[model samples]
Target: MIAVGDKAPSFHLAASRDRVVDSGDLAGRPYLLYFYPKADTPGCTTQACGIQEALPQLGKLGLVVIGVSPDPVAQIDAFADKFNLEFPLASDPDHGLADAYGTWVEKKNYGRTYFGMERSSFLVGADGIVKNVWRKVKPEAHAVLVAEAASKL
Candidate 1:
């Protein structure tokens, strides 16, 4: 997995509201890149909402938020609309983003095993270096914690 001080992997993803968010364009700007298993799901929804609530503080810190999931652009749009989320909820249909960030891995659930995205978040500083990394992040307090960390950056 990408760790603190590592340069974040570059990506150009299709996001909600028919937008495209690219790492290259965010150069010299701080950002929070968060990976989730699926859109509109319980945990994902909670995390998204929490992040949305933190947008004011995050924006003041000049930290752009980008959410990534394995779902398609259409589904991401639906979820964003349902929650009134303002940040980019990107689609990673090929799992390339997840793989690049090392969020893709073997997962076991209900006596079954499969490949899926691990709930994680990366805080990248203005210089494009990863400032902090959170793996298996708790959905409830993730945004608050991330904001606190970003403030330190």
Candidate 2:
């Protein structure tokens, strides 16, 4: 996974509807880049909603939150709408973005081995250098942790 002091990889990703979140546009601003296994699933839902609730505070701290998942645009759109999520939830269907951040990894579940996202997050500063990282994130109370980190930045 991405670590502190690393320069973040640039990206132009699709968000809900016709919206797009581009790294170029977010330059000189602190932002949170998070990876979730899937959209609208139990754990993912918990994390997304928590982030949603923290949006106002995060905004006040000059932080933008963008979520990434291995689902397609349609699914991401549906999930955002269903949950009333205002933050950008980018679709990374091919896992290219996840690969760049090293969140796509090997996993063993139910005696099955596979490659998937490792619920994680990165805090990128205004200069595009990663300031903090969270790996194997727990869905619950994620917002508080994220907020605390952003406050320090």
Predicted model with the maximum TM-score:
1
Q: Which portions of model 2 miss their true places by more than 4 Å?
A: none
lDDT tens digits, residue span 67-152, model 2: 99999889999999999999999988888889999999999999999999999999999999999999988999689989999999
Ten-residue segment with the worst summed lDDT in candidate 2? 12-21
- Predicted candidate 1 versus true structure: per-residue lDDT over 1-153, tens digit per residue: 799989899999889999999999999999999999999999999999999999999999989999999999999999999999999999999999899999999999999999999999999999999999999999998999999999998
Q: CA lDDT of each candidate?
A: 0.95, 0.93
- The TM-scores of all predictions, comma-separated, are 0.98, 0.97
| Deviation in Å, model 1, residue 140 alpha carbon | 0.2
Candidate 1 Cα lDDT to native: 0.95
